[model samples]
Target: MNLYRKVVLSLVIALPLSSLVSAQDAVKQLADKLQVMDTLLANFQQTIKDSQGAVLQQASGVLKVKRPRRFYWRTETPYEHLVVTDGKILWLHDLDLEQVSKQPFSADMDKAPALLLSGEIAEISKQYQVQALTSQQFVLSPRTDDGVFKQLTLEFRGASISGMILRDSLDQTTIIEFSSVRMNQPLADEIFQFTPPKGVDVINNEP
Candidate 1:
């Protein structure tokens, strides 16, 4: 699952910081951006590579996210799977294996990039240092070594997220590029849930 989430974006806002903007200002900027994105849907291409610059895996997927903790992510090829959450219960489904794993969206998962979309922005600001690389790009570095990834870079096309780069502690890198971007769009809540089909195994650990 680390590989799956390693590709998740660590996003914030990109603004002029020529005057050495303080952390508080950066956090506020990111909060405003997140607030505006009440919902987001997009097509994404994810690539995972090793430190040697060799490609390890690549896949395309659709991602839908609703504010205050609801998201649906599905990988369409090379290995079909989904990672979804209905705000409380998190689900990981492997279509190839016909299995689903369920658990609470716990504090641990908050350490992942998904927090940028679903968790509290104030809390997130506590964990990452945000820096604007350009007017359309920003980098987020985890304040602690314990974060799942070492560094994250996000690119935006005028408030709509366009790309992400996540580098883990091991130096492995994952790049994600977004297309067909839609923001503040209506997304039905039911899609964020996982329903087990006949013959699929379910491992439920959530209450």
Candidate 2:
């Protein structure tokens, strides 16, 4: 999958939910917390597991997200891959493949989970049915069936997001743990701009 799809899919997955008034309240509180931060930067370790709970893949990376619509995600270990979006264009660079792909940011892309990180909290309620498992842990199930993810779980440490777990229709599970998280930090505008290096083939995926 492309970087955009990967991140978006990872952010939305399916999980079972239990109805409880306290859980719903916790979800609301978590939404309130997300609304206060305009930017998030963190180091993350992600692990993917099969339906049988066998490890499928593991990777570590740095993730930076800016409100409205901008982000820089780089996987540093296992391999080098970068994905950046400057609100108008999306760039994916595959260091091993020596290729870079570009596509115009479209409305469909706006529906991705990047929006959940940057868009208004009210929109979140409109898109997902949230159930809180604990004061700091919440599960979100997409309101629409068009999404590939079945459910997504988010865990927070105080006001900072500490981990995320996603389960897809195929029963594959992806767990991402965060550390060194810094919220509302000033990130340079240039970090979201990508200029493909010399000798790397540039593929225009925009139609």
Candidate 3:
């Protein structure tokens, strides 16, 4: 599976050091919030809408993330699909099809919005221009054209990430609202490990 597509995955703020102090401060605060956690587990509701605001799809799921590139994501609505990465390999499983596809984890996955929580603060600053929209909201615009989304906005409610909005080049928007967020919680290592079920086809794409 194409990680970006499957994940619905989707900057440089410029200013004098002194003039940017407040912006920098906001960025730092958000970064600190993200970095304080080793693991995060949350329930999420995602909606995709077209430019005209017509609903295209909706899904609800659970997500687990471990720092430095490990995550388990499952969609429990309309159908069931699971994507797991153990910092080295990525697995995409389709329960209905009873098939699993595996590939070596690649750095590009870092661009996924969910993974940003595990990324370095300095790297985030370098990759996107950050603007504080409100005390609890921030807008990030990519520095390059390679990203999957045109821009992303993150909303925080007292240090807890509350929502994310991703707008792609096609003008389609994907909004994800998170709840039941548990941060820095101990997650089993097995959760990040994946083994194909009995009789399921396995396709390995690793190089």
Candidate 4:
């Protein structure tokens, strides 16, 4: 997957609703839960599968987020790929290609569901209708068809987020399971910033 799409996919991670609670209740509950995660650090495993339940791709990474729209994602093991944004410029670095891409962070990028945990409580209610499958599991469906993701599911284990599943328009499913989740911990701002290395192809997509 293009790291951009994967980043966006990872953001809109709310899914399947069993509706034990009202939509309004779900939205409020989810918002309240996310609001508590001002700074989050976690290890994640991402699995992509086709509609037939055949696995297509698997990757493991570390995810970090801070309130007011800062994020850092790193894939280590199979390859090294990174996506970083500080609510300003966004960077994507691929070690195999020896390339890095940069672009200005726009309003659309701010709408990413990742911000839901870091900030933007109102946007959650505005963008999606949420229903509770259980007290700790919630499903969200976008209000419009423009979003690339069709539906999202978020699962919480105890007070920490444990898993998320996103299904896109193409019927491809991406499952993210988080481990070693640490929330509301002090994190240095520098973690969200990046500088391209001395010897790499730097692509400036910013206008």
Candidate 5:
């Protein structure tokens, strides 16, 4: 699967609802959570289901995130793909393909979900229009002519993000669930660096 498909397919689930929450309230709650977080470490269980409500795939991993665009997503699952991003570049390594892909941070800054990884919370409001709070989630739709991703739904447990549902322009939905999250943990910058192995195909998609 491609990167977008892999990411989109990883968030389906059939778990019970943990609580009753409001979307408007959740938006405020999400904003507060992001506002307060400088760094974070956590284990996540992502269960992706199809539109028919069938489980497609499941993956678990430990995520380490630092402020100003840095993340380490190490997967322990059916397949392995390592994604890392420094403030300057994004690296995606496919274990199965033994291939590495790199892109300039600025080239795909708007298209890539870099803001979601970094502490760039200030621009979210400017780029998207916040909708009314729902019973279990808050919704936001992009205000610009951005390609593909049409809307984003965020599900929360009190303050922390419990899940995220993304809808593309094609009406395909991708849901992401986050659990056991630890916030404000110290992280080393070296963890985000990428060095491709010998003989592996390297695709540089940066402009």
Candidate 6:
């Protein structure tokens, strides 16, 4: 499945960091990187093939990231969905289902690997250990929480993240490759705020 599909799969479970160096020092370095507000936008194309090497999905999109937590994700082809977080709340919109689900940005934010895909590098590296895996790739494994994602591999060329691979407890891996990254740009605040369609089902987890 593709990254987007994996995201939706997370919803079904009501869902649900790292480092190398010294686990504590690594987390600090990662948190530092995430604090950098230099990059505001990233674009890439992803190919997701099953473990059997069968083509499963292909997608392209841009990711807008802002510091202190905020991002907007948009995808193209096959189907469409929008995922946004405003540091406090996470809004997931399913186009086909015409439904939107809201969760505290912190609900599973710390537990889900998907957040790492779009999360601040500093925050991520802080929670996990960082290991140099080849020339352009790195692997991050959780230091405190082992029940979430077993491992996360990230590929980079310079400061741009070229790809992401997530390994969960179920042994399912979701990989995303990125290209055409444009960093240090300006993205509007409205993009991170989504309004679900009227009359659509709204599932509020608030008690």
* C-alpha RMSD of each candidate structure in angstroms: 4.1, 3.3, 4.0, 3.2, 6.1, 4.8
TM-score of 1: 0.85
- Among the numbered candidates, top lDDT falls to 4
> Candidate 1 — what's its lDDT?
0.74
Tell me how candidate 4 scores on lDDT: 0.78
Tens digits of lDDT, candidate 4, 92-174: 88887798989887756644555455546777877787887898998778777765677878999988999888777778788
Q: Which structure among the candidates has the greatest TM-score?
A: 4
- lDDT, each prediction: 0.74, 0.75, 0.75, 0.78, 0.63, 0.62
Off by over 4 Å in 3: 1-23
**Model 6: which ten-residue window has the lowest total lDDT?**
11-20
TM-score of each: 0.85, 0.85, 0.86, 0.87, 0.77, 0.76
RMSD of 3: 4.0
Query: What TM-score does prediction 3 earn?
Result: 0.86
* Candidate 1 lDDT tens digits, 1-207: 545433533211122334545656666666666677888899989888899989988888888988677878788876787888887788878887788878887655665764466666667667777876666776788777774688878788888889888887778888889999999887888988878788888998765
Please provide, for model 2 over 72-171, each residue's C-alpha lDDT reduced to its tens digit, 9 standing for 90 to 100. Answer: 8788877788878878888888887798988886645544553466555666766777877777888888778764667778888998989888777788
Model 5 per-residue lDDT tens digits across residues 52-154: 6666667776677787777677676756777777878777777877878887765235334424646476666555555545545656776675664677776
Clashes of 4: 4
**What is the clash count for each candidate, in the order shown?**
0, 4, 6, 4, 7, 16
* CA displacement after TM-score superposition, residue 154 of candidate 3 (Å): 1.1
